[model samples]
Every structure is written in C-alpha cells, then in structure tokens.
Target chain A: MTQRKYTKEKKVGEGTYAVVYLGKTEKSRQIAIKEIKTGLFKDGLDMSAIREVKYLQELRHENVIELIDVFSNDGNLNLVLEFLPADLEVLIKDQSIIFKPGDIKSWLLMTLRGIHHCHRNFIIHRDLKPNNLLISPDGYLKIADFGLARSLGNANEDLSSNVVTRWYRSPELLFGAKHYDTAVDIWSIGIIFAELMLRTPYLPGQDDINQLDVTFRALGTPTEANWPNVTALPLYNAINVYAPPSRQELRNRFSAATEKALDLLIAMTVLDPSKRCNSTQALMDDFFTESPPPTRPENLPSKNTNKKQKTE
Target chain B: MEKTSSLSISRPYYSPKELSYLHSKTIADSKKVIYNQRKHQVYQYLFQIIKVLKLPLKVLNTSMIYYQKFYLFNIFEEEFEDFSNIEKSMELDPFNVSLASLFLACKNEDCIKKLRDILLVANKIKDNQIEENFIELQRKIILGLEFKLLQILQFNFNNQISFSTDSLVLQFCKKINLNYKYSLFCWLVNFDLMLTPIGLTLPPHCIALAIIIISLNFKPNDLKTRELSSGVNENILDSLNPKDFKCPEKLVNEGILYILDFYIHQYNLSILNNYLPQINEDLNKEQIFKFMNLKSKFNNLRTLNEHSIDGNLLKQDESLSLFDYSISSKGTSRFINKRKRLLEEID
Candidate 1:
C-alpha cells in the first residue's frame, strides 16, 4: 500500500533489472524502494527478487536487511526495503573513516552472525561481498541483496558453479565443483573479514583463472594430500601450476592481525571447502569470545549522519 | 502495533477450517463451483506444463501455492473497490495465471526456465499453436500477478510442506524407527494435500502427523500400544489423538478428512484429465479480449524516475495505494515492525 503511505523522494540508483528509489512513509520513516523493471524480465519478477523476498521474509535478524513490503504499481514490482544509507564497501573505501581491529571484529561478528542465522535456516548467501553488507545510520551492519541466496537442502543436487563474484568465490566453485555447501559462503565471509582488516579486497582477481591463481597463492596451492577429491573437480585441471604458499607467508600478508584473528581467518579461508570454518564455528573462535570484543553498533564507525539514514 | 510473531497467524498457519471459510468467503456464490472447477482444471494444465518443462516437484508445489494465494487475495477485490481503477483489467484468468504462476515458481525455486521456452510450452498446451497474447500474458504475469501474488503472500513463499515432508519422513522413519511404508505413504499423501484447500490451510507439521496416523491403519488402541511397545514417547500418538491436543488437533483431523476425500476423488482423475476442453469451451473469449484491450490503456506507467509529484500527494492519505491489499492485510505492518523491534532489542 505504498501509494498512500509512502512517498517516493528521489531516484538513488538504476540498473537494467531494477531501480532503487528513496522513499518516505507517512510516519516519515525513510525506506528504499527497489522497483523491478517489468519489461526487462520476460518472466515474472526475476529469480533474484523472488529469492530475496522469500528468504528475507523468513529470516528476521538484526544483521540482515529487512524487506518492508512488496507491491505492484502500474506494472512495476516495488520491494520496500529498510533504507540502509552506506554499505560496508562505501565505508571501507572511504579513506577518512579509520577503523581499528575492534571495528573490524565488530563488522565481522555481525557478518558472521547474519551468515550464521542464514546457515542455521539452511540458506546460503551465495553472494557475500562488502557491497551486500550495508550499514545503517547508527553504524550497524546489515546483510542485504539476497538476490543470489538459496537454501542448501538437496546436498547432491549439482548447482550451477557460475554463482558469486569471481573475486570472492570459493576455491571449490572456482574449480567448478557443482555440489557444495555453506563453505562457499564461509570463504566469501573470510575474504570480507580480511578486507575489513586490510581495508582492501584480499583477492581482487581480474578473472576466474586469475582468481584461482591468487587464491592458491594466498592459501597454499591445494594438493591431493591436503584436499581429497581436489583433482576430480570440473575445472581443477585448468588451474595454473603454482607453488603452494607457506603458513609463514599467510602470517606475513596480514601482519597487523592478532594471532587469534589470524587463526580464525586461516580456519575460515581453508583451501578445502569442507575444512573451512562455518559461521557458527567462526563465531565461537577466540577472535570473538576472547581478548578483543566487537565494537558496539552505535560506537562503530558510521559513514553518514543523514537523519533519513537512521534505521530503527 | 501488533507483534509480528502474532502475524504468523496470517498464513501457512491457517487451519483447514479457517481456509475453507476463506475460500467460501472469497469466491462469490454464483462463481464458487465454476471457480473450483476452473482451479482444478488449471492445476491439471500446470501439471502438463511441469512435465514439458521437466521441473521438479518443488516447482509444482510452489506454483500450486502461488495459484491458491492468488484466489485468497481475490477477497480484497471486494473490500477495496475504491482502488479498482488499475485492478479492473486484472481479471482472474486461471489458465493464464496458472502459466504465470508456474513461470514465477520456476525462477523462485531455481529451475530457471527461459520465458521463450515457457511460452512455447504454454502455446503447445493451450492451443497447439502459438497465439499473439502468449508473450503479453507472460509480461502480464510478471508485471501483474507476480506482484499481487507476493503481496498476498507478504513475500513469505516457503512452502514448508514439501521440505517438512522430507524431514518428517526422516524423523519418523529413521530416528524414531517408525514404519517405513507408512512414511512413504505419508509423503505421497502430502502431494495430494497440495491440490486441496487443506494444503494451504493446515500447518505442515500437522499434515505430516495426520498422514502418518492415517497411513498407519492403526486403531486408537493400537496407536497407544505401538507407542508403549516401541518405547518411543507418545508425542505422535498424542498429536494424532484429537482430544489430547489443542489447536493442532483440529488441523490434524481436518487434514485426515481432506486426504481421505482426495483418495476418493482419485477415481475421477479421468474426468479431470479431460478438463482442458471444457475449460476452453467455458472461457469467455470476448470478455478476455475486452480485458486485454483495457490493459493497453494503462500501459503508460509512471516510471520510478519521475517521483516528485507523487511524493507530496501520497502523504495526504495514510492508506497506501501502491499495494493497499497487501499492506493492510499482510505487509510491513506486522513483519517489518517486528523485525525493527527485534533489531533494537539485539543491543
């Protein structure tokens, strides 16, 4: 019922599939309205919109973005989402916003918690990147854009490996492993975790092959001994032969991170998807429960104080 | 505002009796029989489309859920007649809506069929020849029905019965060491339930339990004895026995009756199989063409880019026109506010 209660303020962004508009409810609550471009998709609303609506409806958590309402006006499908001002990518790229290890921990904690909730609900956020991790005006991190999210119910079902962005994709996905689990998301979360710490994408590969090279270089090149059934993967033979990195090399790369943080990172970014630390395990790690506590949402760095950006 | 948790009472939580009432209330007295007959015929057509598309049971299950929800939402058409300007052209074409619902379900369930393929399939099924409106119908489904469908669902599209059937089978058959044949029977009964109003009405768990009890062919005394002899807690037995339980008992009993009715109806499958011709014969082609012509009149849509004027005007009325049917009945009023409260409580 957005026609009466919510007023579209301005166009914030536009894409081929959808348009993002800033809107205000009658109570003056700011909301983001994502209008699905009707004529663009021959089929009804795109699968992404369906996935986002379905999962977001079921998943109600602080760290997850809220789907306010869904409506059709004229011919366009509008998704009234909780207005999240600045995403993590914006804040992380902003040089002026300085972040401590605690800040990094806080962001990661929220990310893991969101991912944990999703995983517990049997959902896998296939696309987990900084851009998808939106920030509220109060500095809380919310997981958004469930477009690529899906439930991992049928373990044997061969999913299309062409999911998740190349840079953040897991090694198994890179090698064209069709049947995978939550480890794919865990790898992405680990990369974002590293990005929050380093203030730059850990593996910013230009392409799929390059992504494999960088991934193997960062975490030692996976061998038959380390990752069983590695050679049997679809694209495993296409990989560039490179010497595996040593543990010392990984430590040197993130020298600023504490030992516990490094341990959690190593567990999360393990070469084998099966061995990777899941969201729940990552939350239980010493990085969260021990020395450095995650920063409070209010105290965490905020990109903008625009009153409309304040999320309830 | 009412707590969002209470809004779970809205859907996937409705009792069979409640849903029966909903169906009676939504469908007009004159059109009820025709509507019911048309819905089953359309479901048969959806099955045909599913076979051609080679979609899994999940997509069929999802598509059926969407179809039922569309009719449930027809309830609002009467209450909110003031906003009928745009919705007037949105007539209930069960055939077209069924195809559209399946098209959306394929994507939502991750089957990912191309619109062209879906149109080709629909063309093959409907007329054995392609029609000009097939593409337009697809677009209408995406633009018209999909939005209304989601609004009716409040975006909660998880048809838990399918998933729950699998889990219940595993729990009852493997974990509790229940009858394996009975579990399979229960699983089969679930698909039949989807075709009935009971599918949309009863909770998944209640249906699963009812199926088990019905399939077990156990007398009331035997069920108790099985529980005692098997050393398994009487959880299932208690749930199955209507007297001991609360709200769920009515759901279970209603589910059993529905399943039994469905079994008796299976003999009429031949009659259902021949419904496609009857549907074609019954369709008001002139009325459909008139609605299609009406559709083109509203094609000059207000783009999201042009928003300044609509902004100020919307503030005058608190009731939203964007999707009042969705908002007032099953929108952010419950789900979003509860989430906001949850987030605030999370430190």
Candidate 2:
C-alpha cells in the first residue's frame, strides 16, 4: 500500500471545481495541492482538471508552473503544483508597489517567454490573464491554470468563441471568431502589458456586450479596410465606428511608455489576428532590447515585501 | 516513523516479453482465446459508437489504445463472456469498461463529449432500453471506472510521442510527397495497428514512419479507399530518413516488424482486409502471404534490443505490478511521468 506523500497544511482557496490546499512534500518542499472535486458535475471528472493534467504534463519550462506530482487520496484527485504565493494580479492591485519601466519589461518578457513555450508546442493557453500568471518566490512568472487551455486542432474544427475573460478578450474573439489562433493569447498579454503600466485593467467593460464597445472605443473599431475579413466574422457589427487611435493619442494614453514599448503593444493588439505579432515576434521586438533592460527576476517587486513590512 | 505508503515512479515501455509476463498473472491460459475474441467485439462496438458520434479517427484510435491498456493491468472479464447476454451482467460488463475508456480518450484527445450523451448513443447501439434509473446507474459505474482508467494510464495523457498516429501518417505522407493512395494505405494500417498493442510499445511518429515504409514496399496500387488515382512515388522512399520525423531507426524497425507480424496473423480481422484486395497482384499470392514475405525479408533488421532485460527481473519491477485501485483510498498514489523527478524524489 502506498502512503500519503503530502500533508495538507491549510485550505488556501476554493473554486467551483477544486479546492486548493497549502501543503508540504515529505522533503519539506512547499507545494499547492489542488484537490479536484469529483462526482459533483453530470460528467465524471472535471474537464478543467483533465486539461490541466494533459498540457502541464508535457510542458517543462522555467517560466511555466511545474506540475510536481499528481496523486489521488480517498478518491479525490490532487495536483501537486509548485507553490506560487503571489500573482501578477496581486502586484497590479497593490498601490504600494511602485511600477518601474524595467520591472514592467521583466514581467512582460517572462510572460512572453512562458507563452512562447506554450505556442511553440501548439497548445494555446486560452485563459492568459494577470491572475493566471503566477509569481514564484524568486519573482519568475510561471503561466498557470490550464483549465481553459487546448491544443490547436485541425483547420476545419470549430472552437468555442466564448473563451478568455471579457476584459482581455481580443477584437476577433469579441466578433465571435471561432477559428482564431495564438494571436488571441498575444492580445491578452498586450492588455496585461497595458494593465501593468496603468496599475489597473486596461479595458474593464461592464459586461460581454459592453466589452466590444469598450475594446473598440480604445483600440478603434475594426473594419474591412484594416482587418480584411472583419465584416465576415459571426458577430461582426459596427454599431459605433470609432477611428483608429493615432500615435499621438496612444502616446497621450500611455504617458510613461517608450516609442518601442507602444510599438510592440500596438502590434500585439492588432484587430486582425493574422496581423498581430506572435509570441516569438513580440519577444524579438526592439522594446525588449531597448535601453533600461528588463530587471532580473529577483529584483522585481513582490507582495512578500509588503507582508514583511506589515509584520515588522 | 512508519514509512508512509507512497509509490512514485515512472513506468518504462514494456517489451512484448515483459507484456506477456505481466499478462500471465492477470489472465489464465484457458481464458486467452476468450479475451481476444471479446476484445475484437468491443472494438467493433466502440467503432460503431465513434461513427455515430461523428468523432475524428484519432478519438477512436485513442479509445482503443486505452481499452487495450486497461486490460493490461486489470483482469480480462470472465463474467461478460457472452456478447449476446451483455446486458445480463451490468456489474462487470466489458462494454462499460469500453465506455469508460472512450470517455477518458475523448477528454484526452480534446474532442470531449458529455458522458450522458455518450451513454445515450452506447445504450441505443446495444439495444438496451433507456430507463432514467438505468442510465443514472451506468453513468455512476462509468464515472467510477474513469478514475481507475486514469490510474491504469498512470495520469499520462501524452500517449503518442507527438501527434496522433492517424494524423502523423497523413503528415508524413505529405512530407515525403506520397500521393493520396499511399497515404490512405498508411492510414488503413494505422487504423489496424490501433486495435493492437503496437501503440503501447512504440510512439506514434515511429509507427507512422513504419507504416509509410511498409506502404512503399507493398505499393498497394489497388487500395479500395477513396481517391486512389495517384500512383506511389517509389523514388521518395529511397531518400526517406527516420530522423526527419523525429523517429529513431531502431524504434521504427520495431514498429515495422510489429505491424508486419500483426497483419500476417490478424489480416482477416483487420480494417486493411476490407480495403485491400484479398490477393496481392504483385506478389501473385494472398494478402497474408505478402505480409509473410515482408516479415521474412525484414527478419534480420535491427530492432529494440530486449535481450539485456531478463523476464524474471520484469516480475520484480514495481511499475509492472497490477494497479491497486483501492490504494488511493487507503494512501496516496503519486504518478510522475518524468524519470528524473522520481530520481530527485529518491535523493
């Protein structure tokens, strides 16, 4: 009989499908054990848990959250993952943490590297958001929560258009495009990049309907002239035709951003997915190589600093 | 301190001899014939279900692999011996096991269908009356067996090395510029290999390359599959390299021999039999004789060397031990795919 390898110390979080527990391995390595709740849904096992195990097992990278081990105890499926105490969302929401130009570059660089690994493997991290980007103790960004991730299938296969959070959703996704590619993830990363600078969500819409209006209002309405097949999308509608933002307008909006930084952001958030820069292209952009190089991982701002200050 | 019972290790690929050694403990000699017969019936049944669902070929291929892999660790059912009276015994039905395998395979392949919907199609195919309580009961059984299926699979979803074998066959054929007839021939062989243990032994890319090599050698010009107008490009075969498809030479050799042996013995029970002519026009003999010819020619080809590993040593291998489904209930059963991680844990 196999004995328990991990001891659950305390419950950290709970979602609809799984309850996450702060745990420790026998070797005293801290880990987060996500105990998936089964027998609750009409389906046998949760699809998210299946997706998590499927992709995470194959992917091994420094910027990707490590799926340490998968074990089952008392019929509950537990995924032992590398313990990440903080996330990009926490840092973004924390007003005390001052954002530096180099700090933002580091986070974005790490995020692109992680996403590049996923895209190269043909697996799209469909739900790439600030919250999904976990920060390790050393401040390395590891892409986590593969519940919504899926490998790119055949050309004719129809993917669900209703994915990615409403705020970070791309223009193509907003128009109900079912055959979008890795560009969708790049769009999310671009929004996250904007959010890192602004210290808040770049495009915070009230609801799904408002998301399109908000997205177009900021990035300008996509038309056939800019995006050739924009009008052909399933939900394509030009209720309000806002003109594309000029370089001066974008500069005014992102006052602290460099010209190269804005260039990469613009390329990533292109309305037409085909025209959008991929992870590889974005990683190779001049913004990443310009002056004030990305801060080292350990030097990045973390939530742990605030905690330590409060205790002192 | 009492050592906590936690088994963390990666299972190595089993050779044919090791596979038979493990099977000997799970299956009795008398029941071997019955097991093969039932497996064939289940394969046909699953194929029907897959067709009705309009699932891709990869889903069917994966489901069959999972079903065969499930029986490797679990006992071959004796209660559900009679296919005609399958509904009589609901507790240990092989059909339920097949359904569970399909369910997991669908999830793994990303062509997910609801378990309830899958059950509706399965029950309808079996001509079993769809009662609400019966559906609910069977659903629970399939759900329960799903966890066991995961345990049997050891939480490893990447069964194929790269893409699914069927897709890789098409991709490799296109890479070598083989025409539609040759590609279809490789695909038909892949369809046949799915029902065998070749998938368990070799990666999909190697199997794909092996099938392509066989198709080049056989040059099935009279294949009955659609779009058979194009002729086989024999010149491309001479320039073929296993490294191009990320397949090792020895593994491809293993796949080539395994596929040939499978067709030589089980040609009558294969999808290839339905498509290809019974008598090979080139060889002036039966189809089995063509496979036999290929087998004799490749008799001295270098393949996976299993000579170093002893059969007695295989018995002592902990990963080969029969999976204890109840182990998770009593203790933790850790599944790690990487051997390096297991070594680190040991350190």
Give me the candidate number with maximum lDDT: 2
Q: What digit string (tens of lDDT, one per residue) describes model 1 on residues B152-193?
A: 665556754336443554455454455534444455556665
Error in Å for residue A40 of model 1: 6.7
Error of 2 at A242 (Å): 2.4
Tens-digit lDDT string for candidate 2 (A148-224): 89998877677888889889898888888889889999999999999998898999999988998898899999888
For each candidate in turn, the TM-score is 0.75, 0.94
Best by TM-score: 2
Model 1: lDDT to the true structure: 0.67
* Per-candidate DockQ vs. reference: 0.20, 0.62
The CAPRI-style docking tier of model 1 reads incorrect
Candidate 1 chain B, which ten residues in sequence have the lowest lDDT sum? B218-227
CA lDDT of A241 in candidate 2? 88
Residue pairs with backbone atoms closer than 3 Å in model 2 (clashes): A2-B5, A3-B5, A3-B6
Regions more than 4 Å wrong, model 1: A1-4, A23-28, A71-75, A302-312, B1-10, B13-22, B25-40, B73-93, B131-143, B159-172, B178-180, B218-247, B264-347
Error of 2 at B224 (Å): 3.0
